[model samples]
Target chain A: MQSENSSVNTEAKKIQTSKVPPSEGFREAFLLHLADTTLILTQRNGAWCGHGPILEQDIAITNITLDLIGQSRNFYQYAAKLINESSLAPSPVEKAGDEATEDSLAYLRTEREFKNLLLVEQENGDWAQTIVRQFLFSVYQYFLFEQLQNSKDDQLAAIAAKSLKEVTYHVSWSADWVIRLGDGTDESNERMQKAIAALWPYTGEMFMQADYEQGIISEIHLLKDRWIEKVKTVFEEATLAIPENIFMQSGGKNGVHTEKLGHILAEMQYLQRTNLGAKW
Target chain B: MQNINTDFKTNPINNKASQVPPEERFREAVFSLLEQVPDPEVPVLSILDLGIVRDVKVIDDKVEIIITPTYSGCPAMDAISMDIRFKLIEYGYKNIKITQVLTPVWTTDWMTENGKKKLLEYGIAPPKRSTNNEDEMPKCPQCKSANTKLLSQFGSTACKALYQCNDCKEPFDYFKCH
Candidate 1:
């Protein structure tokens, strides 16, 4: 009787361990993805701080960048919390047991760990190109956040709800500029078309959901596909044609980004890396 | 009894009309004086008019003013904070504390009815509540027309957007709902 009870107890333990769900790790990865995109884009937009095409536009773009930075901070903070709770290990391990705080997680991560899409890191080309890039990105972001507001995760839903309002304005602003440049004069329209053609390749990366996103969708019931449909509808209304070129480029999700990201990181991490433990 | 009478008689009303405690009067004065501080973005509107000032408190001979920024990242927030400090100092309040409250997030819904009326009169559309339902349309500030179209979501400031009135053919700025 004692031997049989011991065997049964061992079997129960095995089943209990096996029954535990696999670590979704979705929330952590999603937060990092959002943070990387916002942080990099904020840095790019910050370059236009003093040198906008016009005074009003300069102020507008800078203001938008500030909003992005604020959003990035909030998202990164939430991501840090998620990371602390998740069982997933950090990639390209360097320092073991070095707990990452929100600030450290944002500032300390190496280049390969970032998961931003390549488009956000692309060079700002010219003023027209920048507007087009922003327009395209904002439209997608607005739609994405709109759907994300209903996410089962309360924190993510709250962030999405707040950011959706801001993204709506951002999209509208970019859309206006797109239409103005697209429908304006021969030179303006030509430039607008050129910008669109240049940025067309990067659009595919925004919609590509990988295993991390898929896991989250299955576990948390997140609405990732809905965001894509909403984006498509907006694109249709904007009188813009979706690029049919099936040859898509994607690497940012895997932390393989363009060369520009290296330089961006150098600038962003200089102070933090050089002066470790320094407080402003 | 003699001491209590002395205290009551020492009240400003008994000694001189202007010698009252000045707590209530000072608060009223500060309210009016601060009303002159215009919103950095929309100069035509006062900070009080926009409802950014949340509370005014006086305790232990110190003045505490609470304010909320229109947007979290608004550059105007720093300017507004500085402006409040300077204005209070200028008003002879030696110990003034300006506290910023970030929760409850500032929304255009805080704007006074008169403030909204003024915004429309100034050709700027007042903000409308954001709705998840799909049937709502933003009205134009100039013509009060529902036929207006959103020209762009981004406006001159983080808090506004550019919209065009189809009826009047005028382009106006819409104060965005936070």
Candidate 2:
């Protein structure tokens, strides 16, 4: 019989070793979590490229999407290289001929194969909703990158250091928008509050430790405190309050995602799946 | 490709002979040749001027030029690699390889002084001192005014911020200090 799905550490490790070495699986999955989260969020943000409310704001969000895409590519490239090198099982690695590329990782994986957080896959409901989602995630990411800059892995550390600069801007821009919309017209304020209520449940999964990320990205609860403090100040300035004791969702790190993820993959992976390695 | 150049067997790498290793000579020649490959986005700046080229090594007559991406998803990198490959091949180097490294990330601070000057002359304000100060607006490249207001932190490109000169009433891109 298979082990309980709720426990991702041991079962996931056991299941993974049939294909890869335990150490390699851990490192590869850790890279996937980072890469997939940004790649999904960028997909969400990138939908605003031509359709944003205003030209300037449209360009601004598009630019941010570009930066996140860059970050995602870096992580995916590293992950691909890792997978290419470490797959002990030749039969499975040879399924794709032992060539795992950034494109394959992004465009080929099934919903359960993706390790992105549920926070990013939530619908971009309205302008206020999107901004709130970005505000919450960017605040968390800013601190995460700060801690990641000191990672024992040189490649991860370098990527984090480079990404911290970009995330700094994302945090500020989203924070400003949160405040602007929260204190704006009554309709805007109502929508902002509603978005926060809808999105807050997904925020808790970010701090939950996945088995693969144990040593690679540790001290999740410490980052949570700092993340809360920063968000609290911003929310207070925006005349909003940090909500209390909500039921938090988890399992994204274990690749158990929401129904939204399936739809996202359907749309995003269409071109790649249909054509298979079609290049411009 | 030029009259000034000698054959690879004849030591075209600046007259330095067996005293310098063949790989080092190939590296030197490649570095100078790369100086001629302009960044596709900012044509005034070369890959060398932009500081993306990290290291050059030659292994068994294969020239490898190592570079770091300025941004993770920078579109220019593909073109730069292509340009580099074309330049190397044109220069009679048959086996050339381009490698991208990411341990030490690229930063605007790595850009050369001459690159900065060229950027200013090309009508985009060069990156200011390597400080991530949002309050400090760069001087206008057009009017040379200190009074500038940041319109948007995100500009036409990932490495630029949109700003407007208060005096000149003209908007310009400020090369971001990333």
Candidate 3:
């Protein structure tokens, strides 16, 4: 792994010297939204790596984390290229002497510049909360990836097509847990209900359109009802009640985030920040 | 039909000539050489057996191999790609290129019949064909019993499921078909 990190030094330098003008469009923001959301959530999910309720469950969650992070790597790599080819942002486009490698884009960005969802940034409180958060996000991702798989953009379509299968498994696995714990003992049911109430407010932002999503508005709107229907089915099967008429939290898509995101970045980026350009 | 026969009779050697184009012959040679490269995870199965090798092209004496990973985070892909390059180099093929494609996402259904047989023989149950019931339990490769229960949705790797046979009381891995 150390050798692998060092091996990219040459390519990284080449990327820096090739000063391609940033591509102009909403695509860079859209790609960052996908990449940041997954990357931030991956760090949060990594908190559960060795602390799962059981060995198998721990392994399962860790695998989920790996999958999410891998997906983020793909998005970040694509986003970095788009950022290089265009002049779109205050982020990933670095100051003098600094190049925006995927690692730099991920580790060096400030919290104010990140465009992830608040729901993913919120702390993983408990196993129930974690499961609930995963379920809600996976439901949205399922719908999003379904449409993305057929995207006119070939690279996005290819990435989505590969990621869709893995995310499908994530949806099923998390939904199964939701159903089991929701219908289990009274204590477990109570916890699941609480997690749902706390997390439901953040889910609304998933459907709320960001400026970058303007191009995909109608495409996203087409899948909104299906996402709702899918979540509704799982909640019903889980014997959990849904909260209605509640306010939904927003603004994470616009670079505003919960305070939790800063702490997550502090911890996840600590090594990279402290040891700048250090391999492995 | 008469025209076709007459054409063949006029240049009878043409059947042998056109049947194997130079490109096709080179492709066959590349495939045969690639067969020596086994999957990083399941060393018994070749990349062809794992269905990751999507295409093998030889153009102007240069070789290009196309591959797809089983999963997005599959750790074996990098190793497998490196192994392919190394083996090709060892086989004296210069100017080798390995391209990774994600479109038309890979499925376990692409695993060859011989691959499945090898997996079962190696004590790993191959993924079953797509069925409406996702909960369908795979037969235990150890005891050939259908009364196996899933121990974990995830196993040693992302692409496998852990199962334990009730009768034989043995744990095994099932290569989950995506």
DockQ per candidate = 0.18, 0.44, 0.29
Q: Write the per-residue lDDT of candidate 1 for residues A36-145, one digit (tens) a residue.
A: 89889999998998899876688778878878877786678778766766566763221656555656876788889899888898888888888977877787677567
Q: What order do you get sorting by TM-score, best first?
A: 2, 3, 1
Task: Please provide TM-scores, in order, for all candidate models, with all chains considered together.
Answer: 0.65, 0.87, 0.87
Ranking by lDDT: 2, 3, 1
Backbone collision count in every prediction?
6, 1, 7
lDDT of the candidates, in the order given: 0.71, 0.82, 0.81
Per-model interface RMSD values are 8.5, 4.8, 7.5
List the candidate 2 regions with Cα displacement exceeding 4 Å: A1-24, A88-98, B1-26, B132-134
User: Highest DockQ among the candidates is held by which one?
Assistant: 2
DockQ of 1: 0.18
Error of 2 at A71 (Å): 1.8
Identify the runs in model 1 with alpha carbons over 4 angstroms from their true place.
Answer: A1-24, A84-102, A218-240, A277-280, B1-69, B75-106, B114-156, B161-174
Q: What TM-score would candidate 2 get against the native? A: 0.87
Residue B78 lDDT, candidate 1, scale 0-100: 65
Worst 10 residues of 2 chain B by lDDT: B1-10
Give the worst 10-residue stretch by lDDT in candidate 3 chain A.
A13-22
